[model samples]
Target: MGVIKHQSIRSTLLIYIGFAIGAVNIVFLFPRFFSDTQFALTRLLPEIAIILVPICTLSTVPAISRFFPYYASHLKDKENDMLTLALGATIIGFSLFVLGTLFFKDAIIKANIEKSPLFITYFYLLYPNVFLFSVFGVFESYSGSRHLTVFPNFLKELVLRLLTTVLIVLHYLSWINFDTFLWLFSLLYGVLLLALLVYLRRHKFLYFNFRISRVTRRLLPKMATYSLSLLGASLFTLLANNLAPLILTSSKGLQDVAYLTIAQYMSQLIMVPQRSISAIGLPVLAQAWKDKDKDKIEEVYVKSSLLQLTYALFVFLIIWSNIDSFFQLLPPNYSVGKYVVLCLGISKVIDMGTGLNSQVLSTSRLWRYDLYSSVVLLALSLPLNYYLINHFGLIGTGYATLLSMLVFNTIRYIFIWVKFGLQPFTMSSVKAIGVALVAYFGCIWIPLAIHPFVDIVIRGILFLAIFVTLVLAFRVSGDITSTIYSAVNKIRRRQ
Candidate 1:
């Protein structure tokens, strides 16, 4: 918990910094510099590749965390075959993907040509985008396994986004055409991969042990089984999540894709704490399971729930409270995504409230259930997406995602509680909900300022004051209070 707390906070701060820069990029720069269709291409390309990353890496993202404890405790880094097998699987998987894409190239074009021609114009660029993304995914997981996540996160969340800002600016200035811009955009992942590689190599945590050691040979069978099963889980879940974007691009065209992308981005702003916490959580759970420390795992589960929910609700309120103002900062067309933001934002808060159920389940002995959960999500979400999107359009996509996530998290919660006697709620959970409601209602009727920025400042500060004060007074999380007090003490000592 100590390391998780320290690193998670650092990583969370870094993620927030990235989000700040990224907000400017997505909300301001891209929209100003590119057309809706071109912006959709930028968004959709990454969507396609993110879906491909897990399969291309053979689900080594989770497998690396799951198996790293064993490999590290038993074998030296030079002899550790975990990374070797991970990279090998990625190479093979990516090769097959390329072959398949080439074979079906005409079919893919046929599907998107009429609706999303801009997407298809740059379709081949997905190869570089997904491959580099896949490689980075594997390395990032390995870095997290070593509990040295802050630096990798800095490169990923902060540095990459900062560089992206430069790329978009270059295009905006007419220094590079869109073609070259897209090419460089795809290659940014390559730069990110190279940076992480250098970091891992310097830290002595990365080496290609293609020569399978005795220990690795013994573990290969289990690792193989784990990776393949998790791959099914990863693929199904990603596909289900993207069903809206895929259907929109094919049916409604890039215009809707643009709206959905922006809405999704807005909703993701609430995910920083959850994202930061979960990144370091897997390795901790893996080691806990290794030592048979059920208590430690349970403690992490409950604390993560409280801490994540506390911030999740806090951020969710801040965003929703200022959503109108935030949208005002964007072009008028993007305002259509208001409902999408609401649906996804509420859904995200619900998932964060459930804590790290999925993370713990993946690292537990009940990992096979992780696959089952994804299958369930796919089954529920596919029909929901088709039905709702047919009826509601882009906002329908948000509703579909929200409902699917609701059921998905419910199922995982049930599974974890039934199997492991572990649930992530405490008394603080209820209090966190109370805090959010109070802050929201307390601020909702406040009239908007003439300027959106001024409205945001006024609303954000009022909400923060009410929320943080109540949270600390209620001791919604001792962790939160202690951290605040610790910071205050440091300030006092410096003064």
Candidate 2:
């Protein structure tokens, strides 16, 4: 528990650091400097890459987890064999993508490029970025299985974002054109891939031992099988997340896509804590499942849910409270998509409130349940997105997302409750919600007596202070209180 808490804190800090850089890039730099077309290109490149990541990685995450314990045990010759297998899988996956692209080149070009003349030339940039990002995902998952997450976190949350920021600045200075920016993105991904390879080599985890025993050979098929199942869920999840942007770009113009992108970026801030918790939770959940530790699983379920909701609600309030200020920071034109923020915010809130239920389902033997649910959600998301985006434009997409999240989270919660009797919320959860509401309203009402910014600052401080005080007063979980005290003591000691 101590280790998990420590890792969670460290990961959260790193992720927030990354988020800060991302905020600058998305909120300030990109929107401020880039034209609507450029911004759309920026957003579209990533969506394409994310969609391609699962296809190119071939669901290497489950394989990495399944194999890492073995590689760790047989650290000498077997490490090389694992590396060899990973490299082989990556190459095969990439080759498949290339072959598919070649076969479907006309359709791909026509669908993505024909409509958006600005993105036509840069559409090819998506390939390398997607390929490298997918490869990085494989390595990150492997590092995660080894309980080595910080470096990957740095690469993901800090390094990549920092690179993007630097590139954006260069563009601002008129040093790099949009084409250069797109090319740089691909190159940056390649650099990260190289860095990962170097790290693996330095740690002696890059080589493949060809000492293929009968057992190891037999395990490959099983690994491949699990990887496929995991891939199905992963692919569907990525599609659901990115389909809105794809549809928006295709149906609407680049300007519309740019606005929705900003909204998506702001909404994503709400999920940072959930992302951090899920990162640590997945491997732990996997191990617990392997051990069949029902108590540990239940403990994880409850604690992770509470903690995630706590942080999520805090972020949600902050975003919602400062929604106007957030838009004020953007250009007047960019602010047109303000409602997209509310729509996406609601979706993320529902998602975070569910805790790490998806992680639990993904890592448990009940993974198939997740696959089924994900498929249903994906099916629902496409039509919903198409309908909403067509009728209501970007805000409609947000509404579609909210609808999808509602269905998905409700189903997951109900299933977890019925099968495992593992409800994430208790009376304390209700108390936390009450505290949040009180703080939110307090912040809103107090502002009536003051200016917006001043009211925001004062009410924000009061909200946080009062919220903490109430949590302490109610004594919701001695562990959480102790953790708070420990953190305070550490800060005091440092001072």
TM-score of each: 0.98, 0.93
Q: Which stretches of candidate 1 lie over 4 Å from their true place?
A: none
Give the poorly placed runs of model 2, Cα more than 4 Å off.
Answer: 70-80, 202-204, 211-215, 446-459, 477-479
Residue-level lDDT for 261 in candidate 2: 84
- TM-score, cand. 2 vs. native: 0.93
How would you encode candidate 2's per-residue C-alpha lDDT over 166-250 as one tens digit per residue?
9988988999887787888777878877887788778866655556654457577877776788788888888988898788777
Candidate whose lDDT is highest: 1
Q: Cα lDDT of model 2 overall? A: 0.78
Error of 2 at 430 (Å): 1.4
For 1-495, candidate 1 gives per-residue lDDT tens digits of: 887888888999999999999889989988888999998888888889999988799898899999888888888878887887888899998998999899999999999999989988888899999899898998899889988899888988999899999999899899999999999988998888898889888887778877878877788788888889999999998998888888989888998888888889888878888888998888999999989999999999999999888888888889999999999998898999999999999888988889888889889888999999999999988899888888988788888889999999999999899999999998889999998899989888899899999999999999999998898888888888988998899999999
lDDT of 2 at 468: 82
Clash counts for the predictions, in order? 0, 5
Which residue pairs show backbone clashes in model 1? none
